[model samples]
Target: MNSSRRAQAIAPFHVMDILARARALEAQGRDIIHLEIGEPDFPTPAPVARAAIEAIENGELHYTPALGLPQLREAIAGFYRKRYGVEVPAARIAVTTGASGALLLALGALLDAGDEILMADPGYPCNRHFASFIDARPVAIPVGPDTAFQLTAQLVERHWTENTKAVLLASPSNPTGTLARDEEIRGIAAWCAKRGATLIVDEIYHGLVYEAPPQTALAQAEEIVVINSFSKYFHMTGWRLGWLAAPAGLLGGIERLAQNLFLAPPTPAQFAALAAFSEETAAILEARRQELKARRDFLLPALRELGFGLSVAPQGAFYLYADVSRFSGDSFVFAERLLEQAGVAITPGVDFGAVAPQRHVRFAYTRPLPVLQEAVARIRRFLAERRA
Candidate 1:
């Protein structure tokens, strides 16, 4: 069988591969501490789970409208209004299978073959691959701690080739957990608007911030679309649901594509997600957020003490991207040794991008306090033995 060029161009998700190996080890009775996954360790809020079960009992298991349940769309719109003080109309919201589906529709509709989209090098790989899936090239802009590991207006201006069609950004980004500031996002959005390009912001980790809350990009640029998911802060990873708030002009095309591609997102999941925004659910999620903060506070200093280079600490998300050149020149090799010797699993930066990948690794604090502590202890022992 022949695979398409698009399939070859898209890189495999390395973390999932690492996870599979870790699972293999666990099957052999190994006690592995998993810090490689990106999702929260928290359970779905009881209300949301209860909603799904109730909906099923009531036989609300049919396909939703192609754009999603109208009420769920309205709920998502209302969430932006209440949380970010931004008025997002329900008409502009398109619910899809997940953030993955939303990205597929957005990139597929907006880009033609050979079109270029700019994104941070050390970003969510899936974002870049979505462009490649549509035969659109994703230009990786190398970023560092100075830029908070986000694309800036200057980077956009510098990388604006004739074929550049759009910009993809993720704040409180994966791997680094670093955020793009509001002013910079505004400037970049303005640049894209002036150049007739589009800006797509991934806000899936929006509700998981440790410091101040993030300002919505929707508020920054009217022409931009916002991508968010139930997977991260809402603790609904397996539910595979998310929504996109596209500009009114782009919504029709995105909706039409959604009709053909997905028909609708999962009906039971849609009904359940209605409770995700409730006050009771918010309380449950906030408590878990505090726990994540505590884990970060403990692990950040612990890793530094253990001599991992963390020049700029993370502001959001459950990850800490560290420079491991001091310990090993190759992150993937070091990660394998760490897994085999210490039984602590993590993701190598090669999974994210080619920018200094050999020198970096990402640690996700998706485990509880005790589990994280145990992983740290094991890592400390592994480093000690390596030095000896």
Candidate 2:
């Protein structure tokens, strides 16, 4: 019995492996403070929870239409109109099991086997794997400090190949937490349009921005495929609900794939997510957003005081992708030591991409303030002792 070669080519999620290792240590009495995972520490808001409860009570837990409930689709479209002022019709939206599902649908619908899809280095690793799963080549365009670890139109032009069928990127990206500029996004859209390439934007971190709001590719072109989720800002990770807004013409192919691949996204999650858009949930989440902002403020200076050099002040996402080469070039070892000695868990950059894996580590500030403060204190002590 043999597994598919494609399955062998992809690696397991490195960050999650470390998280599991840390948890195992904790079971043996090590008090670990987790700053590794990207998930928010908050739970789903009360209104959203209540919506799920009502749906279950009303016996609405049955499987829905393959595309999803019409009301939920309409509500998602209205959300875009109100939130980003982007006019998207319900017919163009496909609710997915998660942003991961949306990515698979987009890749399966858009690319052929051996077709190339350009993505920035240090991007979310799953984007690359999703391409691999479909027998498509995920071409890594090395975007370094010069590009702020983001994909630009110039880089796209430099790397564009005849086989390149699409471009994928995340604003307020996963490992880097760097948000691509609106002008940069517009330029990429124009460049892709001219070359007949599809533009896929992952805006999952749109609402978690600090200092300024993140830009949506939908504002640049109506035909682009935009993937968003209720997981991040809405604190609904476990519910497993997300959506993809693609061109009206692409909807048919996407729907066909969804019908076969997923049947439909979870029914209760879709119904529950409606409340995530309500004014009441918005007010509740705004306070959580501000709390994340404060944690960012607190952690930035603390990390610097501990001598962690950061490339830039992350403007969105609750992460600090710090340069840890000053102390050691091996981030995996550094992360291990931080967890074992300091009782603090952080993610190694190798999980993101191979650009400069040994030199970087990412810390998520999505935990409670007290927990983050204690982790900072422990890290500071670890640094001081090493210096002494």
Candidate 3:
């Protein structure tokens, strides 16, 4: 028997392999400084944790509707109204296993086999895979620092083909951490509307913006499908809970797909996430967001001083997509050597996409200030030794 071609076609998420290698070295007593994964180092907020504990004690573990607990959906809707001043009805929200689930559902609902979804190169890898899982062509248009590592309305038009059916965007994108301008988002939405295509924006890192107030794509257009999660902003990665807001026209299909695919998101997690929008949880998350900003501030200069080429200071999320061409021509080899020689782990650019990937790497500032300081010091030493 042979594995299915679809299964074989998916490339490995290289960072996981890097993480495993880092762990192996740690087991042998090496001191490893991890700057690889995008996960926040903060614990889940006290209110959320308490809610989960209370739900468990109260035996609120039974499956709710496949779309999610009605109250939780209402809470998410209220969050949009209060935070972004955008009105999102609870009926349009579908909670899922995580942002991953939301992506799967959105792609599943929107894409047909042989259809095409346009996305940026150097984007979150799983997105491309999601399109592939359903036999859709994921067209990756290469973008660079000139556009702040984002896709613009012009780029979309230039790349559009007869097969293109949707456009997927990630503001405060995973590897680069750069956000699309609000006007550009509006422009893209307008273009999609003109072309009679769907627009899906991944707002998973919505709450972590630094340079400006966080804006929801829902503010730009209600028809836009917005994907969000408890993982990044709420510090609940392990809980595996997320939600998507679909326009009324897409909600029925999304709900039907959610019912068939997920049955329901984790019951206890939904109960716990109810507290995620509370004032108490907001304060905790705001403090952590500031801490993340501080980490980015600290590490950006430190890495530049160590001779890594970081042209753009990321405006959101906890990553710095760096040009490592001065140090090495290939990012994968550079990452491996850095891990083995410096005991520091960071993700290589190959994990993102194939546009000048050899010249780039992503540094996640998901560590404490002191740890990042140490990683910088080690990288400095590594560079000096390699030069000598």
Candidate 4:
């Protein structure tokens, strides 16, 4: 009745909007300590930056093939081989503007209008937007702490329907930061295989995990879509570079979609991203990962000590999604109060889903240890005052 049904069906990302507001407030002289946005606070690795500069000076800055520069695709493919021990051909990889572009491309390639795609609730909100953008239904599978806030094989099986064409999942998930087990991934893949449903895995946070590295979805299914980015692990969010590795068959559709949608990833970013696979860069990023792990270690225990309950122990990513219902039932109100009263900004879990949304908040521990420690101290003071 009012505009396209698609537009009305989706919700805007509230946490990002709140983060923007908090940033604006900081710009107006408020000392808002940002734990809201999920961005790493590190500069890009020097080698990666140097590569982009060289490419710009050398004029390798023209539009590339839609499937991305062959060399970059080869590099991404090699990344899979070296990191995952999976033999992925360069032909199966497409460099997109970022993981965002990859999500759009994947949804366009796989979904038809009015089709249904299953994704875990309390998951990445953008997945729902992507599905809605393409006129597909994003069926939220209500996942909670009982399953580590993940979409398990049993849940997938229970939710499958005639219109369900795909299952989209993120490992080391965005809000909760919990990685799905390998066996769980395999089971979901096998279940999807039988039902002709596609499985999409978001591995953007793969390199940031504190525990052992996650088993990629590619290891389980030949037909799944895998997305990764240089934003999180490589500290290159502004670079806007990421890649998607799909089954050999899906390459044609994705390439065509990417060609028309993005033309190609940024020429300079792609060139720089090649160096992202270098040994020196790898070592540098590993060091950064260790630093993030340290920040997480500091923030996690401190939050618990200050009386915040965690839905799941985050084994990876730079986020700690804590249950703050004891302090304030409304996460948005609590986050706002934290920003205004305590100078600490955080993301409300309500942005992720409606299930117990008001009870949680996500704190990004990607900043330096001192920053996180200060934020924790401020939060403790705020909670202590509230209790009094």
As for candidate 3, its clashing pairs are none
Tens digit per residue, CA lDDT, model 3, 15-38 = 898999999999999999999988
Q: Model 2, range 1-388, lDDT digits (tens) per residue? A: 8898888899887778788889999999999999998998898999999999999999999889887889989999898889888888999999998898999999999999999999998889899999989989999988776777899999888898899999998988887778888788888888888888898999888898888665478988877899989899999999999999999888999999999999999999988998988999999999999999999999988888778887577888888888899999799999988888898999998988988888889999979999999998898888888889
Hey, what RMSD does candidate 3 come out at?
0.9
Model 3: lowest-lDDT 10 consecutive positions = 214-223
Candidate 3 vs. true structure, TM-score: 0.99
Q: Count clashing residue pairs per candidate.
A: 0, 0, 0, 0
- The deviation in Å at residue 115 for candidate 1 is 1.0
The best-first sequence of candidates by lDDT reads 3, 1, 2, 4
> Candidate 3's error at 138, in angstroms?
0.3
lDDT tens digits, residues 78-118, model 4?
A: 88899999989999889998999999999999999989999
Clashes of 2: 0
Tell me the deviation in Å of residue 245 in model 4: 1.0
What are the runs in model 2 whose C-alpha is more than 4 Å off?
Answer: none
For residue 164, model 3's alpha carbon misses the true position, in angstroms, by 1.0
lDDT by residue (321-356, candidate 1, tens digit) is 999999999999999999988899999999999899
